[model samples]
Target chain A: MSSRVRKIRENAYVMNTIGIAVFIALWWLAVEARLISPLFVASPLAVVQVLFTQTASLAQNTYITLVTLVESFLVAAAIGILAGAVTGAFDVADWVISPILDLLRSVPNVAWVPLAIIWFGIGIESQIFVSAFSAFFPIFTNTYVGFKSVRPSFIRAGYNLGASDRDVFFRIRLPASLGQVFPGLKLGIQNGMAGLIAIEFLDSTSGLGFMMGEASDFFKANIVIMDMLMIGLLGFALTMTLVLAEKRFLGWQRRTS
Target chain B: MAQGNSVLEVKNLTHVYTDSRSHVETEVIDNVSLSFQEGKFVCVLGPSGCGKTTMLNIIAGFIRPTSGSVVFEGKEVKSPSPERAMVFQDYALFPWLTVSGNIQFGLMMKNTPAKVREAKVTEYLEMMGMKGFEHKYPFELSGGMKQRVGLARALAVEPKMLLLDEPFGSLDAQTRRTMQRELFRIMAQAKKTSIFVTHSIDEALFLSDRLIVMSARPTRVLIDIELKSAKPRQRSDKEYSEVYEKVDKVITAEVSKSIE
Candidate 1:
């Protein structure tokens, strides 16, 4: 490697730390200088202090949100992939079902929150329904397009190699479509988190979104900021998990590219 | 060379492709008739988009010709069957399957016993010179190696005939030469009836026992001649040049005719 490139690579982590430290120092300076109102923004110190003080509440609320997120995401993935495979594989089904899905997907997912609340009440059931509804569209659309986009030559090869129609579908089409499905699932998870937080803000008595809202009402800026940071952390962890899973399953794709 | 009985017969095949959206009809194949004897290698050379692939697909039973029939061993070919395996230009090996799995796919589909499938896969792996690469996926291999696996996957099925559609069209010149030599060696040993379609005159000359040159779109056989040249024929040889000149003249004239 060139000296410049080697120097950058070696100091990459140190540079990241320095950058973060500088950002935090600037924020502290802004608080101390009173350029920002104390009522609006929390000082870096105060947010960290709240992190230790409110650990129990943060843990409990995060656990609740995490559970709802997983449950709703699983539900979305199962139905989305199944429906997508069916609709994609059969022309008649695609013709009949895609228009309906398009219409349903057009109505903003939050629009269903009211109906969900009425159906399942202000609880985990309602939360999951709303979140899963939001998550479903991306996963379904990606999987459908994935299946639809299978190379004709591959299908012909499958049949030419003595495979039955069903064999060709299960063996060739399903696995080939998975490369596209991973991106959809990633987007689905991000959207699911959005829906979960939205529903929690509106109706839930538990979860991080509810806790953040309650803190905001009481003017606990530090607690609210800490909760926001926690949400960011959770989203990062979940996305990392998905990326790792994708690597494990689609190793062939990575090697090729 | 003691060629066997007629294995595949194409009688007056014509195909018209219709675009459902634009409602435009394209007559791709124009009443072409041909036949293949058992254990003979036939190579088809044609202008680009002259419906060579359409003819191959029709013979492979992947598509029905608009008119006429394709009969193989006295049976009408209505749909794709394992008996006629094809090697594609793109090397259409399953991306998800390892090399071994790809070669064994046909056996698995046939519901051959596990032991037999394993044996067949191993046999083909050796034959294709891909012995140690069984665990590797298609994407991990070079283009030449991928086509080797593709050939293994096709030949493992013990098909009655092999159909290759520009199998080396995508390869580098050096790799194409290597693959062509490998293919010739393997086919000679197996002595299976084979039909190959390509755009290269030299490739057709180098590989085929019989050669068919096709006309432009709405394609028909312009010439079909048995190559009486000896095996491993050199391009520089007097006989090779004589036949090459004859075939090259026909192709050049047809290409200019299309331009006009």
Candidate 2:
């Protein structure tokens, strides 16, 4: 059984590699045939070359974007999770705040860009605010659901076992909720990154999003393609990191139902 | 039956579940009085949806009785206390916690020192024959194993009274019988006051010293039979069968009348 699982994993990796190669080959063919203008579409090789030559500048831009993304997301996750957990723990808090959060969640994260610019101006702060706003709803909603969905029987069992209300929250509700909350956080982080990129593209003077916008304006198709790919890869890397962290933190959860 | 050495007294207990629309009220448990003595296992038997669980919940202080009092050891029961630990039908083991972790949770809640909690967890895990599976999660465990953890968790608290709501109802027949025997052994050793709720006639006869048969919703105690069986009862014995038949007839009659 173990060997079979290992073989399946290896086959999946090979298939993914082949898929990426085919996509690049098709893109290269399209560009070579001049079916599209060079100003509009760049060959994969040209994009890779651009990425290699401008490695230092790209890396610097990526670092700045990454820092801003992390700062904003962490702040939002901390506050949103804490608030959601608190509201979920207390009935009155849930009754008062859940409706307001639901209303806020309905408004698109991009819709906040103008307001964020107005509040924090066209800088890193505005971009961070936009990212934080985008990330907050998913984390809050998932956490609230997690907290509220705890089985009553568990609570009763805990109480009967001599647990205090505080004990019930910390030991039972919080742990139970994490099973739901982590997935929400993973989604929130990805959404927050996307929001950050959008804000940067619209108004920033630095970072990968800004670089993509500037390249598009100059019709530097290779640079634009390279920057876009970098953005996607970065997002993938961040998401994978979060997933790994979740697995480690929730090892006990994986064992139970 | 021995009387007047009551460890827990429930007087005129009543519980009502309110309808959301139209403000209608339906009583789950009607005015009922009962007393349980220490060092004896008491079973409350009734048909399904007969408020047997509701009565247990009232005593456990999970739900308030609309118009009565549950006095435990001469004090009025206002809320859930550590003195009354419960075992649930579904096991209700914390899915996120390991076997040892679940067993230790009650002690941790009482701010028991880490060393004492660790020892107690190890002791209970061993007692339940779950020594090596301490780190296993609930999903990895069989239904019987999960129930054992639930039992161990309740026992670890050393509560004055143990409340069991059909603790073995969800297990297989063989497992249920084994669990019943194990529970009897544990109860014999601990000698804590206990109240068990179940629909099984055989189960009630085997574990309980006194069986309180209840009528359907807005429930009331119909027959309180005192069994003379020795501890660790032999289910195949004539005396056990006779008691089972008697209790079965009483419950069947009560259920039929309630349906009518």
**Residue-pair clashes per candidate:** 0, 0
Q: lDDT values of the candidates?
A: 0.91, 0.87
DockQ of each: 0.74, 0.63
The model with the greatest lDDT is 1
lDDT tens string, model 2, A42-80?
Answer: 888889898689888899889888899888889889988
lDDT of predicted model 1: 0.91
* Best-matching candidate per TM-score: 1
* Alpha carbon deviation, residue B220, candidate 2 (Å): 1.3
Question: Worst lDDT window (10 residues) for model 1 chain A?
Answer: A248-257
Model 1 agreement with the true structure over B1-260: per-residue lDDT tens digits: 55658999999999999999999999999998898998899999988888999999999988998999999999999999889999998999998999989999999998999999888888988888878898998878999999999999999999999999999999999999999999988887888899999989989889999999999888999989988878777999786798789888988887888788
Question: What DockQ does predicted model 1 obtain?
Answer: 0.74
TM-score of 2: 0.95
Which candidate leads in DockQ?
1
